[model samples]
Target: MTALRTGVTALAVLLAIVLQAALLPHVGWRGVVPNLCLLVVVAGALTRGAHFGVVLGFCAGLALDLAPPADHLAGRWALALMAVGLVAGLVRRDERPTIPVVLVTAAVASFVGASVFGLLGVVTGDPGVAVTDVLLAVVAGVAGDLIVAPLVLLPLMVLLTRFEPQRRLA
Candidate 1:
């Protein structure tokens, strides 16, 4: 059962990554793309727990790093996303799993992810991106994640509940 759950979660994360990289760019608002990967990581963290969240975050970040239109320092994304996952998992401790929590976690995780990426860029002396660009992207990603969280979370919750009714019964 746990293996099945992990497989499903991994598939979901891969789908989210592909969609974010392929479809989201075309649907960008004012040049800001939503961080769908972050949403998936947060959702995974909330549902699964800290260790799974960290592993998922690392894999997702690695995928993002390897995808086309790459960024500098490959491992930066991996580390930043790991932090986001850990933080989101921590959030799950106090917050109930709901749309509100999903939205809030997405927003917060977006900010933290972008900030960590930006700081790493600076630390690496990469000339990097502009601070304003990073901040704007974070804000836009947060808004986009908040708007999309309920749509994704609702279906995910339904599917998970169907597969693991005991989870909901508890």
Candidate 2:
């Protein structure tokens, strides 16, 4: 049953990634795109735990790393997302998960992820992005993720509740 739950969660994350990479980029406001993948990763970490979160985070980061228009090192996202997942998982409690929590967590994770990526770019001597640009990108990404987090979280919660009996019971 745990295996099944893990499988389902992984599948859901994959689908979310595909949608995020393929569709959500086109649905932007003032050039700010939603980080649906970040939201899903946070949700998974909140629902599961650190171990699961780290594993899933690596996978999600790998997908993002391999995505087109990639600029940073392959393992940069993996490290950043691993940290995000670990933090989220550690913070999550057994209490009822709320929209605010999910949104805030996702937003923060998005910031951290972007910051890590930006720092990596700077370290790697990517001249295109300035320090201010990295900060602005983080801010924009957080705002965008917060705005669209609930949209992804609600459906993800529903799917988790429906598919994972453990979550339903919780």
Q: What lDDT score belongs to each candidate, Candidate 1 first?
A: 0.76, 0.76
Question: Once model 1 is optimally superposed onto the true structure by TM-score, how far is the C-alpha of residue 57 displaced, in angstroms?
Answer: 1.0
TM-score of each: 0.85, 0.84
In model 1, pairs of residues that clash are none
* Number of colliding residue pairs in model 2: 0
Off by over 4 Å in 1: 92-95, 157-170
| Residue 104 displacement in candidate 1 (angstroms) | 1.3
lDDT of 2 by residue, 1-82 (tens): 7777778877876776677767877787666677666677777777776787788788888877777766567887777787
